[model samples]
Target: MQVDYEVIIVGGGPVGMMLAAELALARVRVCVLERLMETTPYSRALTLHPRTLEILDMRGLKAKLLDRGKPITTGHFAALDTRLDFSVLDSSSNYTLIIPQHETEKVVEEWAKSLGVEIRREEEVVAVHQDQHGVEVVAVGPNGNAVLTALYVVGADGAASIVRKQAGIPFIGKNSTFTAMQGDVVLKNPPESGVPSYFNEQGLVMIVPLPKGMHRVVLIDPERMAVPKEEPVSLEELRASLLRILGDDLGISDPFWMTRFGNATLQAQRYREGRIFLAGDAAHIHFPAGGQGMNVGLQEAINLGWKLAAQLKGWAPDWLLDSYHTERFPINTALLTNTQVQSLLFGSSEFSPSVIALRNMLSNLLQIPEANYRLATQISAFNVQYEPDREMEPHVLNGRRFTELHLRLENDVCQNAYELFHSGSFLLLHLGSDERLYDVIDWSKYKHVHVVRASLAKGAPDWHDVHTALIRPDGYVAWAISQSESNPMEAIRKGIIHWCGHV
Candidate 1:
């Protein structure tokens, strides 16, 4: 049978599902193909950064995710028995959120389904062809061969992406040199105190807290010392190794899932190829260091989703579609580099005495207020900022990470600034004492933008405490003029146009 959609997304993992949801919410017809018949039971990624939380909050899934996961207020970096808690970071989001990747995917899938997106499970995409008009995808489903045609194609299909391959895009990078095994196991004496811990030895032994008193562990050790290659890794053998390293106190019991992976860092040379584009792991793969793999992928989906929708809706300028590659490619490349750095710290055991001492010193330094805050910002991913130099003067906040704030509008009532951003339109926030900037914006001509005003009766003015800010449809700050601005909108406009184009 033949089907048609505004976009056909390959891969139904978290990233793919997120793209599906975004497309459906934009009222764009979408079809997502998944090779798996059911969701994976493994807790692949359990840490959700504050930035990712903010993204989910936009979809109204934050509360539910928090309910399903535990909040880790502290993280400790240790050497065998000695440890240093890096949780004292003076930052807005001081903790790591531990929500299983599967649960996260469930929420996104439900949201996509609610938007009436078609999800085809057990359907394997075999080939992709893009012509001048659109893209044609062939897949094998349960009954027989099926074809799906769409104006655009998005590959969120993980590290080995069929769409990217069929589109002749190059995935450039090195395969993982470090070998590690990850699994969810029952520990006899799991820590019941603050945040879980990482017991770094020759290789890393991490214990990450999961909901319902469960925990996930990733053990990275020398390949030779690891158990012999076997179809199903012997739980008893893994338990023995744990006893040898982390000690017998763990009392490892039932293991829900066990898998081994090597540290392979790879990224697509280009994210967009003609009418087909790549997002998430389909575009890049890196070490699961700092819990950034999943979060980075999610951000890619968010970055691409709105742009694709805008282009399909005929609201985006010609160059806007290509901007997806320009903005995100470098970002993903940086993430890959960061992941590689983290692996060296946690995955390798060839630490000289000097190196060990240096690590300890760095750990202590990270405890300092400024260092902790910086680390927190890096790990939590709240430091993402877009270029702010391209839009018109008096531009609404553009090309930056969106900030959360509470505001009292012209009406006596007050509400959260993000609430106003639900429309996914370009917002023109007129801060107090800066209402005159509104004159520069042609609100009547731009139906896609919203103009509003706000004063402090609601919250403070830190970046996280921004009282009034304009958010782009993709949940980024288009331009933010402080209530005490000295006509700073012009400067902000310079940055906004860099991303929003000349619109």
Candidate 2:
């Protein structure tokens, strides 16, 4: 049975395109099936958090994205009065990048195309079936119906995913409790409040700046809480909501796009089923708090992309593929919980004195540096830590993201940790005088792993007395060895086999 592609991704949005690029980087044959012939004009997600920026930096896309976005040093939590200071994060990319989702899609699509990833536009997936070897996807495109087969199929097709439904994956969560309207419009008289957000008994209203002199206006009208998701948003309704919430509409006119959203949250019971997998909104959906919807989806894509490619390439450990679900399911569950709490905090339809008091108390708590930093880490996703499956005692750096480090190698050559990840391979970085560390692993058998001996740059703390560390392709530490360890060579052998499979 010949497969048309090693992987076929449904939905060519940010998540789908990101995964396609990751797989293509590994020399995997991949294709994307997008229902729309052209990209959407609507700008859904408006910001990318710090961790997302770091992931892009690893792929060398961060500079290009920065050129297209506004780097904001601060972010908000549930539109709280207190700001989440991104400038204090312990990463090179210590800020959020504010860019429209359409622009982001364009950048990623361009990268995927450069990697020779085929995107079949206007192809709407209707049916999917899987066998022991591969999966067949039936879609209707401009040329009519067609069937394509791939070793694996990923559903990034949004909350109402046809692929997830056809795969019989349970999407369990709560229904919509409140509705909101968003519009990108030209203002005859713009408000003086720059990127201002207000929440009160009337409702919540926010105005954010967009490209091309257009402004994005979000309105949550208590009276319109019952509006169906299918209902169209009108300029008059938007004006009334703004007037009710913000005292004026700022003379909003010349609308470019408008849409309605709800607080319905859901998560797929499982991320994989046989040869089928799910990512992005197909796996989870929740309130658009902290602008995390797209960012989390992109992270999920990166986490799953390389593992799937490794499996197809026949070098993946047995637990590698399943780890995608194990690692990300909990993250998505926490995301849903946070957004639900935010929805409650921001909801005005059921506003009461107690709710206001609660909001005030939480807002005050955010003033504390530790409290603010903790929530900021969660929202920025910098606090994500995976538990290593190995039996050895875990070090502090194990299972944590390998932060970009300045290194001075043997020849006085200087480099950063992110530069080693350009090829999407495991990096074995030795940071001490032990040249014998390289002899421990049989590097000849691991084609995708690189070994480098380097010393930490001056003024950097000696990290956990770590002499050697194994970094996964997604930039997380698989395992690390300290100088005080009794048997470092044997530990390296076990770590390689645990993460990189049989050599």
Candidate 3:
């Protein structure tokens, strides 16, 4: 059998599903293929970042997800009963919502299906080829072999992606020497308060609370490690290990699922190869430290989805495709580097008494302003900033973040500044001191564009203090002007011309 679409995503995981949802919402036909018939029950990422929560909120999915996962309000760095509370930063996002990966997958799949996406399960791609015009993919389904041709192909498969391999993109980086055992187990006595605890002993042990009286536990060792198996983990062995490691802290009894795994870190040299591309685990993989794996993958899907829509609609330039690599590859590289450094810190041995003392001291010192700032930089996604090719206008709002301001329309509907971002249309917001600035823009000239009056006094400072700001469909501030009486139309015109590639 043969089929064709605007874009074909090569994995049905959370990232791929979300991408499909985005594309479908944008009226782009897409297909998603998966090797597994169903979602796995494992709890890979027990924590979701705040930025990710906000992103999902934009799609109206965050409230439902908040109900599924227990929020981890506080965190601790402990060793041998000595503990340091890092909950100060927890105020930013009181919880790292602990929901199973399967639940997340189901939510995304349901949402994507409602948006009209074609998802094919039990399909494995055997071969992939790409040319200037499009990509041809061959996969083996249950009934028979099937072929798909599409303008764009995305590989969200996994760390060992067949599509990535077929694309010949070099997977670079080193695998760690140490291994760890991780599993979701039901305990006899679960903690009343939901908070993640880290134990730094002979090896690192982490306890994360899950829904329905289960705890996602991890035990790590440098010399001895448990081997991975396809079947369910042994309940008896897990109980014994917990008894020895955790002692009386949290009683361990019933086991739901367990898995043993080694550590490895690798990144793709290029995310795009002609018409073939990679996202999520296919593009990058690293140690599961900091719980950044899934979050990074989901963000990649969101970033690429809209860009693909633009290109398919004939509004994006040729170089727009290359921007995916330019913007994401650096972020992936930084994440891998930070995770490696953190692993070294968390994986310290007791033999190094000096190192252990220094670590504890540093952990305590992390409560200070400077140390807190450094840790916050890693924990929060605010540290990431993409550098565009051309220089930004020299102004205060130039290259700064887009704030979520409140806007009131003539119809008396009060909403967020982002409402102007709907329909992937460019929005020019006039918040200048003089209302005359609004008269400058002839709204009738642009049919697809949105113009809004944003008053700072109405709500919190969502965007920076700029008189006039032009926002891209992807929610980026393309051009901004400070309070200026000078004819601002020239700046707006230049911004539109530059971003739309009309010049």
Record all residue pairs in model 2 with backbone atoms less than 3 Å apart, i.e. clashing: none
Tens digits of per-residue lDDT, candidate 1, 26-68, equal 7788999998998897767887877787777766777888887
Pairing residues by index, what is the TM-score of model 2?
A: 0.97
lDDT of 3 by residue, 280-347 (tens): 99998877777778888877877788778877777565677788788889888988887776566666
lDDT (Cα atoms) of all candidates against the true structure? 0.72, 0.89, 0.69
Worst 10 residues of 2 by lDDT: 455-464
What TM-score against the true fold does each predicted structure earn?
A: 0.88, 0.97, 0.88
Q: Quick one: ranking by TM-score, best first? A: 2, 3, 1
Give the RMSD in angstroms, all C-alphas superposed, for model 2: 1.4
Minimum summed lDDT over a 10-residue window in model 3 is located at: 75-84
Could you tell me the TM-score of candidate 3? 0.88
